[model samples]
Target: MSSELETAMETLINVFHTHSGKEGDKYKLSKKELKELLQTELAGFLDGQKDSETVEKLMKELDENGDGEVDFQEYVVLIAALTVACNSFFWES
Candidate 1:
């Protein structure tokens, strides 16, 4: 992965670990776990007034396989989207 992607993934993993109360471990998340984690940790950021529907749409778009869970690749895309969203929100406001 590129350095930026690596950093993003690291940030994501840390965020996941922190929220899941499994800090200091490198466990991979199941699809259900990922969904719950996102809802818990990212719901507010995602549901910002202007982008709530857009963000939900984006999540559905990424869950193409419809497995009701995102694997690592899908998770990475979600993280990337959120990172961009967050940066835009803070920097543009």
Candidate 2:
């Protein structure tokens, strides 16, 4: 993977860790775990959106296989999408 991809992955993993309340090297996050993490960490940014509904929408959008869970690959896609969106927003402003 490219260094940029690696950095994005690491960032997402760290976010996962923060949400899971786990520390250092114990980085096994499940789909539900990721959903909760995203909701909690990104909730304020999501404004007053309903947490469950927002997570569900995100899961559906990111989980291409209809597996109802996001694995590492799916997580990467999610992060990439977010990165692009953030970049576009800041660049436009």
Candidate 3:
């Protein structure tokens, strides 16, 4: 049986790939795909459809190599940041 953390790791990879494969590079997410992933996967945290500038800003910030696409490394930064935020919120609550 997989441990909880292992399952969570798998889930992250799976989710990224699910969106990343939609167009362009199969391994990275294009701006549109990233927007879709954010809007669909994180509707609660980010209303991506409502605030396109936020998505644009995030893509620029997260696209470390500036290749105009979000690679796995860049994507993980977002996940990690969100995780940290969630952890802090849990502690505060």
Candidate 4:
């Protein structure tokens, strides 16, 4: 059986691919793709956003290369940050 950590890692990759390639580059996430991924996968967390620029803000932050798109590595960074945040919240409680 795959280890728990292995499964989590796999889920990340799978989720990224599932929403990617809808527009440009099959390997990267366009702005719309990223928005869809966030809205669907992170509805609970992102639904609280009151700013219309939230998606644009996230895309800007995650697009470290300024490429206007998020590749796997950038997506992983976002996931890892959220994981860390969740870990802290759970442990602190």
Two-way lDDT contest, 1 vs 3, winner:
3
Off by over 4 Å in 4: none
Which segments of model 2 are wrong by more than 4 Å? 1-9, 17-31
Clashes of each: 0, 0, 0, 0
| Candidate 1 residue pairs that clash | none
Clashes of 1: 0
Residue lDDT tens for model 1, 1-93:
569969966777777665442322234444445555756777775464544455455557777677544455676777778679889999999
Query: How should the candidates be ordered by lDDT, best one leading?
Result: 3, 4, 2, 1
| TM-score for each model | 0.49, 0.66, 0.92, 0.92
Best by lDDT: 3
What does the lDDT come to for candidate 2?
0.67
lDDT of 2 at 75: 70
Model 3 residue 2 CA deviation (Å) reads 0.4
lDDT of 3 by residue, 1-93 (tens): 999999999999999999996889999999999988998888886743455887899899999999999999999999999999999999888
Worst 10 residues of 3 by lDDT: 45-54
* Tens-place lDDT digits, model 2, residues 1-93: 569969966777777556543432234435567666776766665578876677778777887777566656777687778779999999988
**Model 1: how far residue 90 lies from native, Å:** 1.2
Cand. 2 TM to true fold: 0.66
| Model 2 lowest lDDT segment of ten | 20-29
Worst 10 residues of 4 by lDDT: 44-53
